[model samples]
Target: MKVAVLASGRGSNLQAMIAEWQEGTLPVEFVGVGSNNLDAMALTIAEKAGIPVRAFPRDNYNDKSEQETDILNWLEDIGTELLILAGYMLVLSPRFVRTAEYPIVNIHPALLPSFPGLHAQKQALDYGVKVSGCTVHYVDEGMDSGPIILQETVPVFDEDDEETLSARILKKEHIIYPEAIRLLANGKVKRDGRRVIIQRDS
Candidate 1:
């Protein structure tokens, strides 16, 4: 499978995926990495890996649609088969989501449904939830509201803050994001409505 990544910040998850791919643990080829921020560390990581990188900074475009159009075109050019979103901050426009040729997946910092959108860790902490975790799911028009592919939970201590909770969830994100991609690459993922079924090896 030919994969591409979209990230906006540190790209820790991208780094994790790259490490697995380099180790031959993940069966996929990274075709490109795209970022909305010109200085995103994800771009640098891609460059270091010798993968193609592109930036579609909103400031350079007249509108969000124009920027997304360019991104879509870039993905088309790269022949991307799977799109993984790692810490990508932009909420994809419905048109873009509908138009993309391949399936798009994202790793979220919370278990989802309960805490979708931005600052999910903070939301969980503020709500005083006893457990918090990460989720890898398909990207739909709604914010973090898509068919879940995988999820792993971690305990939330009374003393935990947003940063601390986020750190814990991030660890799980690194582990599961690559695993989800592996499943996709191996044709082990099946979607049935809002649920994702993972096929076991015979």
Candidate 2:
């Protein structure tokens, strides 16, 4: 499977995926990496790995439509079969979501349906939840509201701050994100409404 990654900031999850691919654990070719920030570290990681990288700066475009058009064009050119948002900050346009021929997946820091947007770790901390974790899910028009693919929980300590909680959650993110992709790559995923079913060989 040919995959493209979209990310912003430090791409620890992206790095994990790359490591899995390099180690022959995850079966997918990273065709390209795209970012909204030219200075994004994810772009640097991709360059270091000899993968194609592109930046679609929102400031350079007049509207989201134009920006998404360029991104779509690039994905088409690279023949991307799967799109992975690994810490990507931008919310995809609904049109782009509807138009994408391939499935899009994202790894969220919080067990979704509870904390969906920015500062998710803080949201969990503020809520005083005893447990917090990461969720890997398909991307729909709604924010982190797509069908759940995989999720693993981590205990929340009373002394935990946002940074500490995030780090722990990120460790789980690194584990399940690639596993989710592996399922997709192997044609073992199916969706029925909001539920994702992982098929095992019969």
Candidate 3:
């Protein structure tokens, strides 16, 4: 699959994706990195890896349709078949969600339906949960609410703080994000409604 990654901050997950692609562990191509923040480390990493990038503010579009159209045009220019949200903070315009004509995937720092949205790791820590993890899911119009792709759990140790728990979960993110991409690339995932069924790799 040809992919364009969108991110809002320093992209550790994006780095993992790029590394996996380079090692040929993930059979995919990342066409570019797009970010709402021009100074995002995601863009810098992409450039260092010799990947193309685009950075534009969500506020630049006066209307949602215009934003969607512009994004679509860019994706077409890059011939991208997948849109991956790797720490991308912007809520997607519904038009972009509906018109991508391919898969849109997102990586969330917590096992979703438990903790979602911003500062998810903090939320989990504050709740004193015994387990915390990461989720990979399809991006729908809603915020952090979408069809699940895959998940891996990490224990929240009794002595763990938010940053520590986040660090542990992020390690799992590095594993599952690339694995999810590989699953899709290899045609092992089938979507039905808000659920994704993964066919066992033979």
The residue-level lDDT of candidate 3 at 59 comes to 85
Stretches of candidate 3 above 4 Å error? 58-68
State the lDDT of candidate 3 residue by residue for 1-202, as single tens digits: 8988888899999999899889888888889888888789999999999999998776898876776677778888999888898988878877788878878999899989888888999899899888889999999888889999999999988888888888999999999999999999899999999879999947
Give stretches of model 1 more than 4 Å off. Answer: none
TM-score of 2: 0.97
Better of 1 and 2 by TM-score: 1
What is the model-wide C-alpha lDDT for candidate 2?
0.93
Ranking by lDDT: 1, 2, 3
Per-residue lDDT of model 1, residues 88-124, tens digit only: 9999999999999899999889988889988999999
Clashes of each: 0, 0, 0
Off by over 4 Å in 2: none
Q: lDDT by residue for model 2 over 48-166, one digit each (tens)?
A: 98899999999999998999999999998999999999888889989999989999999889998889999999999999999999999999999889989999999999999999999
Q: How high is the lDDT of residue 131 in model 1? A: 92
Overall local distance difference test of candidate 1? 0.94
Q: How many angstroms is residue 25 displaced in model 3 relative to the true structure, after the best TM-score fit?
A: 1.6
